[model samples]
Target: MSHTPTRLRVVRAAAALTAGAALFVGGPAGVALAAPPAVVAAATDHSLHLEGAPNARDVGGYETVDGKTVRTNTVFRTDALDKLTPADLAKLEGWNVKVVDDLRTVYERALQPDKLPAGATSNWYDVLGQAPITTALDLQSAYVAFIDAPGASEAFASVLRDIRETDGTVLYHCSAGKDRTGWTTAVLLTILGVDRATVNADYMLTNEYVDDSGSSISGSLMGGGVKQEWLDTSFATAEAKYGSFDNYVHQGLGLTDNDIAALKAKLLV
Candidate 1:
């Protein structure tokens, strides 16, 4: 998951330019400015506000296409929990989190394993374990691989199954919670009928929550701020391969209509 510093810089610079252009175009007179993605996400913030895991938040409060809202305190998404403070652990306990799903690689787990709250069990699903380690710096390709890589669908399906079947709150995370975890969030939200624009806004909220300056090169590459296109690539890949997101969930991940129905019943309120 490592990339040359030169490539990283190039990719980051391109992202910066794209962001700058957005700002510039929106700043022109009479061109009404749209709300930033973070602003939109604030309607459903439900953040855990953990000092160690700033990106941790509830995956709820989003209105579905049919007008129901996803329930809060049922499921959470987060960055690595290896650095949680005692107070953070208390917060998790208060939230009644019963299962913690880890989406990191085996090497990542060994480097910094999660510190679970009392009574919470951990489940590991290495999203990239079955594929050769990729050295490419393209975030889009990395996202597509999350869907196409061997064993990836199984791992993702397992996490969803855990969320669907677990009795209490479940918190799932990767090292930095933006790449693998972001895709997981997107898939879940889409399945629950959240619109594309809102899902993209939810994905972009990582830039406001995660500070990756101190991260390792791999972390920087994986958790670095996301772009709309990178997430779009994942959705496009899923559609191209499986015909639709529902098909991707059913065929790609091998979930049944009953399984998806169960997930919606549990997640939506």
Candidate 2:
């Protein structure tokens, strides 16, 4: 004979099941289930996070129209490396950064000399070589000077030549890496067939990567932070004077087709 289930036993089983469900629905696990997900910052492939150098980033990883990508570890733009620690020096050496192209003026360089890696070579190519800006009331004035200066073409040409001919990584920088340095990279990217939008975006990234609380361009002429209008002005000016960036490279900066071809060959690959 088999024993039958008691009504009391069935009722107790149902109550237990209900209590267990309630625990799972309103307990610690339940709280975790209802909580919001943690937030994570997005990573940038272009940025280099050095202790001493902010606004230091690889100009590579950008795609061109011909399906070729700018090679990483080839060209880098940064703020001053004046405060680089020994570890920072080692970091650059590990990256095989062989040449440092300083775009700062003589006075600026003297104020804060770059601390280069042991074997790395430094080239002082001031944007305004010999001729100083008379009154840098704004970034526009500075750009105007750069565009019209007698030695501007030679100076900028040297930067491109360095990038093309340097055996290893070529790192370029100014004091804050916003005005002069920004223009240099802009012209370089434009030469590599990058669109105007991408070029402008790269120039705008200085605000995100560097601190500008005390940073100023020629004593408050252009300060606070990198402005989009300033970059816009540069593009407009290039258009007005030279018709296009390609023409600007040849006529304004005096870079030849051979020079640009060499740059693409070395940096694009």
Candidate 3:
């Protein structure tokens, strides 16, 4: 049922719920729930989890301004699932996901690929190319990125529009779920009216996941630019380009009125 608790209870309950699900520590939702205490004490701390998929987390239990919470299981974020462990596959199987909207480019998906739940629809919505985001890539680049990336807002909006009419969960992702993934996620959260700092914090979480191995998401401002300062500049760039996070939703991503409304309805409630 929808979370209809009274105002006082709503805030209190949401605070408690946020503590339980720490994704909101970044933005609207991004943190992966830490394993149980017993699991942490085990020799192999994450044996019960998927190692190939870094930073995977459920976007559940964030308290909205109103009393309700974002339902668990409807949304997820992670590095590409192309490298799922067998156990990871089974974990997804348990989530009853109906769609895996992969945001990687055609080349990336063909090269690395994602692991969808058995019988789940593997819808490829390329929101952008696999290239790093920079002035080096133009509007054509953005459109191509939109086309090649997963969770294309225009396309995902279509998916959201239809999914709302149906009854199963949907998950979308890219390699880092940062640029393309970040844009898609930022848009969804923006519709929910989440603050900018929280949204940018969520975007910055990519730095925590992949080893970087010198391969980068956005291009270097200069050589050796993988330093933390450069990453900060990147978020600063997003802020400058979009004016505000919400503007990125309406302007950069071009999420339509109907699309924004549908996402807020599904995610916020």
Q: Each candidate's TM vs. the true structure?
A: 0.81, 0.78, 0.60
- Ranking according to lDDT, highest score first: 1, 2, 3
What residue runs in model 3 are displaced by over 4 Å at the alpha carbon?
Answer: 1-49, 65-68, 129-166, 214-258
In the range 84-202, model 2's lDDT, one tens digit per residue, is 88887887887778899987666567666899987889998866644443423345556665666667667777888888777777899877777777888988888877777677778
Give candidate 2 regions above 4 Å deviation: 1-44, 129-132, 215-224
Over the full model, what C-alpha lDDT does candidate 1 score relative to the true structure?
0.72
The alpha-carbon deviation from the true structure for residue 147 of candidate 1, after best TM-score superposition, in angstroms, is 0.9
Go through the candidates in order and give each one's C-alpha lDDT: 0.72, 0.65, 0.48
Which candidate, 1 or 3, has the higher lDDT? 1
Candidate 3 lDDT at 212 equals: 46
Q: Of the candidates shown, which would achieve the greatest TM-score relative to the real structure? A: 1
Q: With candidate 1 superimposed using the best TM-score fit, by how many Å does residue 139's alpha carbon deviate from the native?
A: 2.2
Q: Kindly state the number of residue pairs that clash in model 3.
A: 17
Which is the winner by lDDT between candidate 2 and candidate 3? 2
Query: Mind giving the per-residue lDDT tens digits that candidate 3 earns over 1-269?
Result: 11112212111100000111221111232222221111011011111135767656544444445454455556666557877887777777776667777755555565566777676787776554333444223322342334333344466454445344434566777665554555555555545665555455555555555454544323311001113333344345545767864565566556556656555556554
lDDT tens string, model 1, 137-204? Answer: 35565678888988789988999988888877889998778888889999999887899877877788
